[model samples]
Target chain A: MTDEQRLYSIWVYLQAEPLFWLTLTIGAYLVGDFCYRRSNLFPLFNPVALSIIIVSGVLLIFDIQYERYFEGAKFIHFLLGPATVSLAIPIYQKWALIKSNAMPIISAVLLGSVFAILITYLLALAFSLEREIVLSLLPRSVTAPIAMGISELIGGIPSLTAIITIITGIIGAAFGTFTLDLLRVKKMSARGFGIGLASHGIGTARAMSRDKTAGVFAAVAMGLSGVVTALIVPLIIFLLKI
Target chain B: MLESIFLIFLFQLVGEMIQKFFELTIPGPVIGLVLLLVALLLFGKYSTSVKTRLEKGLTTTAEYLLGHLPLLFVPIGVGVVMHISFLENRLLAVLFVIFSATVLSIGFTAFVMEKLQNLGNQNDG
Candidate 1:
């Protein structure tokens, strides 16, 4: 048989298993949640973190390609856009509180992004890492889609960006409030805003777990900070020529 | 009733237009949000029924979403499937970035507010 025939056979096999990764993705989600609930340590057991690790392991063990996995899992992926859009409803509902705190929230997101990017970049330089690593590191605080775009535009690897993004979210989920309390941040609004700005979705989840007020601020901050960081981080990188 | 429907339509249209044009990087609903906030501020007075309906509709959706927010990461998780090689080479550096940024943001925000609150306490003392 010629090479053409072999390629056709592989394509045929791929077409047959459209829902494979979808099942795996859902399985990973459920199992990850189970593991998180079982584990006493909330941070270590973060469902998002665990699911990614488990699914990656499963894919690797079975030698499944990402594109093929994504083909089946893309239904889950498709929801992210709408979910992100759905975040606006809360922001609208909380208009009065948000309006009162708009200036402060904006200030926090800007300061938080600068702090996140600068510390990551400076520390990476201190450790003598290459430029690509630094670029990928820069957008770790943003949500995955926005971070991926920022990383790609400034020449960072998207895969590295994805991993770092997850790590950021998990870390934010686990320790955000602990650190906030250590510093004695009593205001739920500020705490939520800071977490949402710094950690995106995971941070927002953690915030929501705290209170309705935290959740509202988290939704606003998560959405708003995405806009701020995506715009500002690239411009800064361009200007600094880093 | 008619006014509320009109509000949704107007807000949604403006939201989509902002998204299409400014690429504000913000979600359209958020843009609609700013518009809503502006109207609220400008009107400075909302009837009880209108407020109740809008708030009720918005809050219900928010509550539902808040429940499953963690599940949304599944898509980005799939991104890992695509870029395994890059993940292999730069695990530490990526880890460092995540750990440091997460810790730093939480630390910095908390620390600054603590200082301000302390200053306020000192003044009262």
Candidate 2:
């Protein structure tokens, strides 16, 4: 069938039975993740990297529209909130360690958040962009969904915010650890905290792959950074009167 | 596994409660996490069997989901196709901000955290 026809059929089916896209997302995720673990290609074969590739192809081949896919795929998206929440279990298990390291965590997040915003704004201004556009670029280091909302609040573009969020996540995943090692960062807690503060979910995922301790710290940093940035970024924006 | 599921459910419920009552922008998982941490601290040590099972299930689930998590952005990619107009208008600005912010985030995070660790050690010494 032509792509349009296929999309139409999928849409009709979706109207009646809506679980298809969710299943596809999960299946694609599983297959891609398995291959990534097997292949060990850091940048190229990353599961999120691969899944996006495979799923995109499937959607094209099936002539499925993005909206149709999103209808069911939201199941996976909805789980994102709880999945992030679930990190609490591990965090709870390691509360003592976290408590001991709390100072470093808070300090790292504060410094990291400031650095992220300052650098983004500075670079954007250097490039000679207008004010609103720069503000839109501010939240790129945060998660995409959150970034989108923040961008809107600050009168920036949501679509642009999403793109920036993804780019930030990928770059952090690819180069975060290399830089960590270059700096001779030895403590798993420090490494994880830095990654989480910078990359959010993507960084947390990378940290988990390294070790459980790293993952636990990354979770703490990611959660706290999100909270801090959500409040702090807007406040900074408000205070700057920009 | 069952306990983890139950715990996660309870945690999720509490998260919803906080979000609804306080209208907190923080996601539910985060609140659930804070709650779970309090519970664990209050209870102290738990039976290992349930904990292990839950961890096992969570491990596989987290591993599977996170690995391919980025692919979930594909639909968003197609968004660029639609927003091609915005792209052409601010292409340089967008690329510059994303690329720089990304590199900066990694660099700044490493720098600050390392400094904090050093400061932490110096104080202890």
Candidate 3:
């Protein structure tokens, strides 16, 4: 084959390979990290958020589907659970602080969970959106998987819930952290759970930037809120008879 | 360090087992975390060898994983780009709710938690 033909084949191979997206993700993050460090600002331009925008741009430019990107990216996704479980390390380290704050933690998660649900529903209704759309939007604050499950359980579309949850997660990670600082919240649990309760895993991931202890409580909120939302949402819907 | 990572996965596996056997809706990794916490409280915290090994594991796992925690969330976050059209007509309301609710919840959580902390402090003093 001619040299041009060989180069064309190689290009196709790169596109087909999962290495492509994986490398792109790492590379973009590297640039994001560099910029963050150079500027000496965490809130101004978060590396994760920057890298995502870069990767999304690349995918759009190349016309690559999310499925193909996920084929490589799932390795990173798989780690979310282990990383979540790894939170035990920090919790174990900070047991004293956590134990002392138990009452507040439980109270915050409960109140925040309730507020997340009611607010999402009321806002959707005020917009005059359809009932099915309302059902879909209700679970927007929970973790994506559980939120999608809750959506389906309450007669909402799962796919829509998944996307809504993702957007919420992005907002929490990108905007929530900066906003938290702007609000000047002092308590670690509040800052962490605020993001966690409203945003889920991504929020907890964002919470990690604050401090290990804060990240642990955020994880606490994320995990418990999942259970709480799962249990209560169906009950609420059933009672309302909607 | 390797030993600690192994322990995390071991706990995760058992957590998955417990989840399946009991039909728990809670995620396996979460269950695994509680199990690890329990084990640490009972066994690791008090024992020097266990503590050393665990600290090594925790730091290594954290260094390798935690620093890039946000990266794990990228693919899903990027997926939001695909549904822009669906959101167009309702974009104003949807964006308004998400932006406002998220801000409100965070503020509310912090406010309530701080108030509770003050209440506890008052009781103590």
Q: Which candidate gets the maximum lDDT versus the true structure?
A: 3
What's the residue-level lDDT of A220 in candidate 2? 78
lDDT of 2 by residue, B42-121 (tens): 65566677656766775555555444445445445444433446667778667767766766676677667667767766
Model 1 clashing residue pairs (backbone): none
The lDDT per prediction is: 0.70, 0.70, 0.78
Model 2 segments beyond 4 Å from truth?
A1-23, A34-39, A144-146, A238-241, B45-88, B122-125
In TM-score terms, which candidate is top?
3
| TM-score of chain A, model number 2 | 0.81
Between candidates 1 and 3, name the one with more favorable lDDT: 3
Which stretches of model 1 miss by more than 4 angstroms? A1-23, A152-163, A181-184, A234-241, B1-55, B113-125
In the range A1-242, model 3's lDDT, one tens digit per residue, is 99999998997888778788788888888887788778775654777778888998998988888888888877777887788778787777767777787787788778888888887777777888888878988878888868887887889989888888877876777677677778777767667767887888887887886567668777778878888889888877777675
Docking class of 3: medium
Rank order (by DockQ, best first): 3, 2, 1
Tell me, by DockQ, which candidate is best.
Answer: 3
Worst 10 residues of 1 chain B by lDDT: B116-125
**CA error at residue A222 for candidate 3, angstroms:** 1.4
Order the candidate numbers by TM-score, best to worst.
Answer: 3, 2, 1
